[model samples]
Target: MRTQVAIIGSGPSGLLLGQLLTDAGIDNVILERATQDYVLGRIRAGVLEEGMAGMLDEAGAGARMRREGLPHDGFDLTFSARHHRIDLFGLTGKHVIVYGQTEVTRDLMDRRAQTGGVTVYEAANVQPRDFDGAQPYVTYEQDGIEHRLYCDFIAGCDGYHGPSRKAVEGRGLETFERVYPFGWLGIVADVPPVSHELIYSNHPRGFALCSMRSNTRSRYYVQCALDEKVEEWPDERFWDEIRRRLPTETAEKMTTGPSIEKSIAPLRSFVAEPMRFGRLFLVGDAAHIVPPTGAKGLNLAASDVRYLFDGVREHYAEKSDAGIDVYSQRALRRVWKAERFSWWMTNTMHCFPEQGAFGQRIQEAELDYLAGSVAASTSLAENYVGLPY
Candidate 1:
């Protein structure tokens, strides 16, 4: 098989990249190691940043989102029992859509399947070989048979652990990494959201977020110790912790049943240099990972694909590889910004006594300042709702 571009991983980044390329009259193939159902069912990031709704809508995948997606102009910042709302649209004229990556993936998949312009190879392994030369091949298996796919270029949207980055090992790529002392235990429930807007709570106990997916489905997150076991913090214990962090009036009537999904994700930050190695390029989580506090994971992926498509277009249209050439630097600017925001939000909201008495005081001061100053509150709200694109 041969294509102009071969995208690894069918996650949002890869799938959106393929769609962009297809829209531009470029042929591409997508390879994923997971079954289609698994990819579509995976529970992941749910917040779409300000400009993301517009970007995806223009890309021909926003019809369903426009029809049924939830929108919020701002979110609530809760400390103790007090709630302060920061109007994101009022402050920055931008607002986020409360939607899940799963739905985005499903919509893209449905459109791609119907158009028949994008070829998705599920349960396939893409091994990029001879990238330094003109033709690169991704070898994989299908229906118990081995096959080789040839493409002019490869997009390593496969994510942090996929083969794309491994293929670029020893290529002098600069890397940065940071792992926090805590992680988030997330849950998706079939309950109506307790608040009309999302609530980000900072309590002596830990950090908690109350966001919803739909009128009937809600999403929530709570900070947990790094080594906390899923078995130890069962549903009952989970709700107990949630109640402690939520606002008074909301918590009194809040109800949760068995979760449709639950999991713990380590809070960490990582970024790779250049976002490209010869004909292979990385986009989204493959190039960067942000702590979810800022709600940037999915938006960053979409932004990276925009850059990747522009680079590919430059290569074909202008006969210049400059766009692809600076892909990493361009994406990293926003990546690091979100990284800083995520780190700041995490450190500010969560109690970090382990860092020392000074650390605890600093966190408290941040909370106080955010609550006291309208300017500071607006800054935090704008970033939380999302910065520009």
Candidate 2:
């Protein structure tokens, strides 16, 4: 019925926050609307920025990642039939790990099960009640029964549509958002990746990415009309687009299997200001979201959890609320920086279908600037490598 902290949504943020609190000898409960299987099985982002990997490693949850995850020190940027590899480690002394979100969730859940440090209430509908009051509770329906979980504070780790965001809608929070005209059609194919390193291609056809989820399983994405449907893209059509963007000379032959999964995710950047409402704090997608271009969704969520854990630990450890008081403002500074980086990367690499010749020329000029100037290239590499946590 009561605890030191109650977390809504069992996504990365909530789960990681719970784990951190548990490690600090704090009691917390996590509520999720989806089944445990769904949360652990769903495919999501795979790129882990350098700092993110270090954080997970320090948290003692990087075992599986160390075994199966691919480590990349650089990625190729292709434009005008030229390939320029940004040496991530050489330029910034950083590296990224290619591990799917599914794997990260599984690792955390496994740790929770073994240590008994977290109470995961899955397959439940969670509603935030009395966030402004000293005593707040999360009411949820589980197995046809309603349960009210009261706690000292609530951490909203839920995604965009979760109940936590709407719970404080009347508090006059500032919202900033931008929706793109295109979406990415992403898929996981049962084949080896065409390239050893991730490739970001700028072609006349459109924007395409070549990445690997694992040694045998590969992930790929292509820009399409925002309203495009799955039914409109057949197997042949998908391969055709990949070939056009990758070009035969540089890309290996893709052996098509049954398209395992497909999704059309609209490109957008979103932020909700003042991520705190009384004792209910918002982190991760519940607070802000960046498009997949910069691969910041899961990493940002992890970073937010780190911040929240530090703040909450200080609050309880030292009998001081100073850390918790400034949590939102501190988190927002990093959030806005990521937002800008993601938006800039998306626009710079992806060409609009309706872009005129002048627009094309401008993009070319930008790429040229990045490629020609060591200063500009280093800046790109630093931002792409990631900022300190």
Candidate 3:
């Protein structure tokens, strides 16, 4: 098989990139080792920056999101049992849409199908080969048969654990990471949110976030020990714990119910340097990861796609390699900024056992300063809504 681009993994990044290429008259095919049902079953963050929303619109997949996604101009920051609103739109003139990542993937998948694009589910042992040379191709096994796919370029949107990143491991691939001491015990329930907008709370117990997937489906999380198990938290216990972390009034107003889904995810900030390796390029989680404190994961993926798509499109449309040549630098610049924000937010909201009371005091002072200073507040708002792509 031959195509202009061979995309590994059918996650949002891979699917979005393929869809963009197909619409631009570029041939591409997606290879996924997992079934379509398994792909959509994975739960992910829903916060969408204006930049990502625009990309979805550009790909002709924004109608459903525009109709169903919730847009927020601001969110509340809680500390000392007091709520302070960070006016994202008022401060930066931009707001984010609360749309589930799964929905985003679904929309992209639907659009791809409509456009007659190719995506192979359950493709086995997918591997990128000869990316360092002028010619690049992918190899995979399917239905107990082995095949090769030749392509002009390879997109490593296969994520951190996928073969794309591992393929170039010994070829000067440097990585950096910091794992937090805590994890978030999250639950999705069929209930209205406690507030119309999201609430990020800092408490002595830990950090908590009140978010939602839709008007009727609320998602909530509370910080837990890294070793904590899901079995330790029943629905009733989870509700009680989250309420205890919120302000009295907000907790009183919150509606509790039996959770439909539950999980615990450890927080980490990671980045792999130099996103491009010859004819192969990394997009999204393959290149970087954030702590999810500022909701930057999916947005960073969109940013990478923007750079790569522009570069790849230019290569064909104008016979230029300038964009692709600098994909790493451009994407890394934004990736580092987001990493910094996520790190800072995590430090500010989360309790560090080693830092003790001193850290607590410093965090209190930081939030208090933001509450009083327009400059500090605007900085937070700018990062929260997302910086320019």
Candidate 4:
């Protein structure tokens, strides 16, 4: 088979890129190692940066999002039982939308189907071959048969564990990573949210977050030991632990119910330099990852897609390689900034195993200053709402 672009992954990054390129009259095919049902079944972050929300609209997949997603202007940060509001809109004139990544994937998948775009699901042994040369292609096995797909370019959107990043092995790509000692025990329930906006808390026990998917659906998380097992934490224990970490008033008024879904996610910050390798370009988790503290993972992916789409569009429309030539340099600049923010937020709110009493005092002082200083709050707001693409 032949196409203009071969995308290795059907996640949001690859799907979104395919949608944009197809809409622009570019031919592309997406390959996925998992079934569509399996892909959508995976739970992910819900907060959408302003820039990402806008990108969804551009791709014609924002109708359901715009109709159902909540617009949050600010969020609460609590320490020492005191709640401080960070005015996202008031400080930066921009706000984020509470739309689940799962919904985004669904919308993109539906759009692709409606447009008759090609996406091969359950592809096995998917690999990118000769991406460094002008004639790049992808190969995979399907239905017990091996198939080769030739394309003008390859997009590695398959994520960290996927083959796209591994294809560049021995190619001199520098990687940076830091894994936190703890994980987040998260649950999604049908209860109404504890608050209208998200609340991030630094309690004496650990760190907790109260977020929502809608007015009637709540998502909450509390820090846990890295090796904590889900079976060890039943619904009752999860609710109790989260409530104890919240402020007295909020906890008293909070609604508790049986959890619909539960899991523990480890926190980590990872990045691979030079997102582009010859005719292949890495997007989203394929190139970088961020701890979820600042809600930067999906947003960073959207930003990478934006840069890559522009480059690909310029190459086809104007017959110029100028945009594609610098894809890595531009994407990495923003990726590093987001990395710094996620790292800082994780450090500020979580209790570090290595940080002694002195570190606690320093964290308290930083939070105190953040609550009192307009400059500090604005800086947080700007990054929270997202920097310009």
Give me the candidate number with maximum lDDT: 3
Per-candidate TM equals 0.95, 0.96, 0.99, 0.99
Give one clash count per candidate, in the order shown.
Answer: 0, 0, 0, 0
On residues 300-385, what C-alpha lDDT tens digit does candidate 3 reach at each position?
99999999999999999999999999999999999999999999999999999897888888998999999999999999999988
* Model 4, TM vs. native: 0.99
Q: Where does model 4 exceed 4 Å of error?
A: none
**lDDT (C-alpha, whole model) for all candidates:** 0.83, 0.84, 0.95, 0.94
- Clashing pairs for model 3 are none
| Tens digits of per-residue lDDT for model 4, 162-272 | 998999978988899999999999999999999999999987689999999889999999999998999999999998998999899999999999999999999999999
Off by over 4 Å in 1: 356-358
- Tens digits of per-residue lDDT for model 1, 2-119: 8999888998888788887887888898889988888987888778875677767766899999888888888888875778777888877778888888999988887777767655
TM-score winner between candidates 1 and 2: 2
> Which wins on lDDT, candidate 1 or candidate 4?
4
lDDT of 2 by residue, 1-389 (tens): 77889998887677778877887888998888877888877899879987677766666778889898998988988887777888888888888889998888888887777768656556466888888998888898877988888998999998998888888886978899998889999888888888788988887778899888887888889999887898899877887787788756766566666678888889899999899898999999998989898888888887788788888999899998888898898889989989999998898888876687777778778887888888887887788777886
When sorted by TM-score, best at the front, the candidate numbers are 3, 4, 2, 1
Q: Candidate 1: worst 10 consecutive residues by lDDT?
A: 117-126
